[model samples]
Target: MASTSKVALITGGAAGIGYAVAAMLATKGWLVNIVDIDQEKGVVAASIGATFYKADVRDYHSLRNAFDDTMKRHSRLDFVFANAGITDPRNFYEAQTSTLPPEPSLALLDINLKGAVTCTYLAQYYFRLCKQGSQLADFDPTLVIMSSIAGLEVYSPIPLYTAAKHGLVAFARAIATPFKESDGIRVSCICPGPVFTEKRKPSDADRLDMVPMETVCNVVSELISPGGGFGRCLRVLSTGISDV
Candidate 1:
């Protein structure tokens, strides 16, 4: 490992895009911490040299404990990936049925929008707190959030997922400037189109339109690099990437 290798924390890192990001960082020699609700994959994460903490992003206490454990293990935290999220197969309209009439799932909002928000808030807090004992550098630490192309444009079928992703994009943009000026913490977002992660069921057409998982990880690597800019929204497509 490099002498100056950094530490990174990724939420929902047990599988899919989160797991890919964790592996990318690990290969680069970063001390990666994987936080997710799945205990089984958490063990797999540990096997790959990442410290795994079973955490549900929706719960503040659960998240805090994970953060605390990460801090205890590592002296400093240089990057955070607020990537935990989920979507219901049923949209709001489809959820209404004459028979059992399932209540609209707040699970989407809770885990997607609110959970990302909570992770961002706590990340900033810990970044500042941990830096208090030492002099801060002009630039280094970064927060790369996982938004989606659904955030930039609307997708009607999954209204709830679209809404939550839109919230993440707005949240990243709104705080970018302030975090840069006040804390020297770079904030950026990645908006990928129809990524073929395990949680998503993509059709043939969707796969054609989808960006590669590696492409999304590269965007995050760019954001975490020292020369990276603040307030950038990177959108990935099957063709390539664009800064929006």
Candidate 2:
């Protein structure tokens, strides 16, 4: 909790890419706040020297409370990682047996696209406050949105997931310019191809050209750097990163 240390709030930081980023930041002496629905992972966050708050990203109030608590404790916010998201559980195009068509599950959309939007709003509000209180001229706050390769291309297996990811890419690009000009907030999207995370099985690694989590984390680190450009969509592959 040094006065000069930066603070970062990450959604779904209990596991996967979010957890990776949280650990990296904590190691770099950042005051990291992890907001997630998994209470049991609180110990995991502590193990990495990060504070964990149990909350669902889909619940706006709960998520906002997490943000409020972070500001209350740290008195400043520098970065926000809107990384909470889930893949579609079932095929959305599958035929239903009922007389009338059943409603397809929107849980993925709610958590991925809608959750990121909520995080963006809160980040902007808090970032403005940070800028108002700071004296430095280069206080560049950043918000990194997590997207997928499905966002840029057609992933035929899960149409709903693809749609949700596409929305995230579009949303991040749409607000990057205004946010930078008005609040000095750097907004960017990271769309990685077939990442090897907790959600993926061991056998699938043999078939998929999966991108390493470390590579993705490196890209995130670069995007949040003070010199990072705004409104850029980076596509990470097994080989390297490129502009979308």
Candidate 3:
């Protein structure tokens, strides 16, 4: 409703880089909506002047309902940050097999790969809708997806993570050329090496690579900031990795 400020919706905005992005956007004078499945994270995001919506990125119905409610409450949607993801460091070959040989849990693939695809599709739909919709002439929807450095250089031991991240990088790049010139919606992705989060731990072997969560925040802030993209996956290297 304010003249200069805008509205931003961040998926996975409850913690880690998501929260950091929310904080940065809020400071930049954006009305932020932090979407995540974690209720606790939602509460935290709400505490920081952001509205919270609990939705699993993999579920279309959930996301749709959340977005519907968000738009109704806010009256407009301007930007989207699809940063929710899961990380499973297990190599594809290293996964344990049962005597029955059950289907793999594939939690990493579901949350990381499929989730990003789903989010982008939905976000793109809304971006186009805003362009066409009469009530939202001000809508210039921007999308910022979160990928990783592993997306560029294949990580030997973490094959699935790399596959998912690499998929994201390609997905975003595939759209960048056409969307930037045609749609007027800017799309960019940030591929951070390793941010210090409770979910991630760099061992003796992986100890040589990583970055701080704050540094990652800075990168995410730059991605959807009305500018274009950095084509390759962003890599936060060794010195940053050493601290983690």
Candidate 4:
């Protein structure tokens, strides 16, 4: 069926929080574009009104093409959830003693921090285009950045990850206030606690202490409503930081 609704482009929409957001938004009548590097997962997401895109988050040209392709295919883009991220923890303190495979390169930083920022700026470009282009159906655009609680506080043990998350949170806030600079774009960030899932297990500590993914989903869903949460900071934590 031809969709007559606005579209949401979700980076990393093939799994994790990105997938969760894509699913909910699709059911809500938004034509979702799931952007991920995983071809298999991308194919699966295409079955659910989400057009899966294979693009590396760190590459600017790759994402530019992806974003351009989305606009050509969807005709209008309403929201962009910068959700692509790397879930790795081998950095900073282990390179000196490592004798294995070039030591997990600074790829995580490139993908998680730099990638998110670039994707966001790309989204902003489209949002501005929508705001000005008369051919666009959805005049107002939104950006839902997937930051983590680690950004708000020093919760995670991995320094690199925590630093990146902190950067994401600060980026969101910095754009939102005096927010007029963003061409009326509603930029918001969601800081989720350790969400329970099966694709992988959390750290040993995370096993005994975690919250349901649904809890986080509910918050994002609410943020979509008219006058829903935006332009301000909110936190979702099972505890203050150390749940032990």
Candidate 5:
């Protein structure tokens, strides 16, 4: 008999929040497909019972190739985690005075906003194709996007990062209803506050109030359940999580 375990595709699954979510999903009997730019970390991910694909999220062709290969291997995709992103420490306001051609650093927008958009577009396409001619009326595919507390509130240290996150929040909300109506694919965003990852600075004020990585993983696990979340943004804090 052929195994029919569900498949989950996660971008930036090599480390941090993305890796935590991928590991948790794998434990729940899911076949995890991890897409990452770092080949070394990708190899590590593959060793942990995940299928690793090397790709740059900033390039749609690279991301699409990974998506196609996963579909070919698993025959179905039940979930997509568009979790690839990078932060910019520069203050855009201060950079406006610079004379360089690319002063403010567009890397944040490219990897965070554009990458997420590419993932969402591909997720919808793949999910729709997977659901073609399905008779199960209860089928619900999902696309979980990664946002941050910056998406909901103002964060001054990283202005570009904040704007990118805010864009993600808007994107998720705008497409959630349409995606649900079109293909029963629920779209949700996770807005976590101050997770203790490599991205966190040791001298930061929020260092003492960091939320555990497990909490974010738990929230993601719950979101994957049948009919659990749709068109919702869950704000996870050190204290508790709430729908925002």
Candidate 6:
């Protein structure tokens, strides 16, 4: 075990923003358990000194098993990042036939909004367990949700993705105070503008407005710190981060 006993569980941690955060925390000696649907990334996680659990965020039971296994192994959890999400797969407005429009796929909502809600519920439950077992007078557990700039504004191209992110911000704000009072758990949402990740090539023209992966990871570090505030949606841009 590391000198610090702090532990974090992150979804979608195999790559992108989630992976960056996990790697950052691992370097800081925080025990990181990554729960991602991509099983192939398990080795990548291990390379960073983080454990990886193969589980889909949309599957409640499988996700819960990851949580259970993490707690069983580490016996403590200080942070949980609900970062799994995806963009709208098909056109919501497009009509396959002249008379009737094809049913819009809601997979985005299931993975983004619903998955986040489930993670939040499980986080609170385990946070309480950690509280009961801890000897420290002030044990604070934090939940950091991944929202997007689209959540704050209209993103016409991906309406479903925008809606899911918006729900995350609202959900975090709605439960922050209550969760803090009830479980001594702080909750906050990170709303970043388009982020530069492996999937996003630098050659793309839109890269100008994209936030760096480092910036997003740094924000996660701040949010999990002892003094990290609750209920605020911090927006990350190419330049810096600010409260939204």
Q: Which candidate is the best by lDDT?
A: 2
Cα lDDT computed for each candidate against the true fold: 0.85, 0.90, 0.74, 0.75, 0.87, 0.88
Evaluation by TM-score, superior candidate among 1 and 4: 1
Pairs that collide in candidate 4 are none
lDDT of 4 by residue, 1-244 (tens): 2136878898988987888878888888888888888888876586677888888998788888889988878666788888888776564665365566564577877888899899988987876665564565445567777778788778555878888888988888888754445476777887776777556554633564576677777776766665654565557666532211
Q: On a 0 to 1 TM-score scale, where does candidate 5 land against the true structure? A: 0.91
Cα deviation at 99, candidate 6, in Å, is 5.5
TM, every model? 0.91, 0.95, 0.83, 0.85, 0.91, 0.94
Model 3, residue 35: distance off in Å is 1.1
Better of 4 and 5 by TM-score: 5
Model 2, 1-244: lDDT tens digits are 3247889999999999999999999999999999999999888899998989999989989999999988888878989999999878897677789999877678888999999999999999988877785775546799999999998999888998899999999999999999989888999999999888877898867755888888999999999887789898999999789988
Candidate closer to the true structure by TM-score (higher is better), 3 or 5 = 5
Each candidate structure's count of clashing pairs = 0, 0, 1, 0, 0, 0
Q: Which ten residues in a row have the lowest lDDT in candidate 3?
A: 235-244
Tens-place lDDT digits, model 1, residues 93-171:
6545476775666888899889999999989988886677644453277999998888999888888889999999999
What's the candidate order when arranged by decreasing lDDT? 2, 6, 5, 1, 4, 3
Deviating ranges (above 4 Å) for candidate 5: 1-3, 95-103, 135-139, 198-208
TM-score of decoy 2: 0.95
Whole-structure CA lDDT of model 3: 0.74
- lDDT, candidate 3, residue 37? 91
Better of 2 and 4 by TM-score: 2
| Per-residue lDDT of model 5, residues 1-244, tens digit only | 1127888999999998989888888888898999999998977576669999999999889999999999888778888999999877665666354466564468889999999999999999999888987554545688999999999999887888999999999999999999999788999999998898766676663565688899999888888889577999999998899999
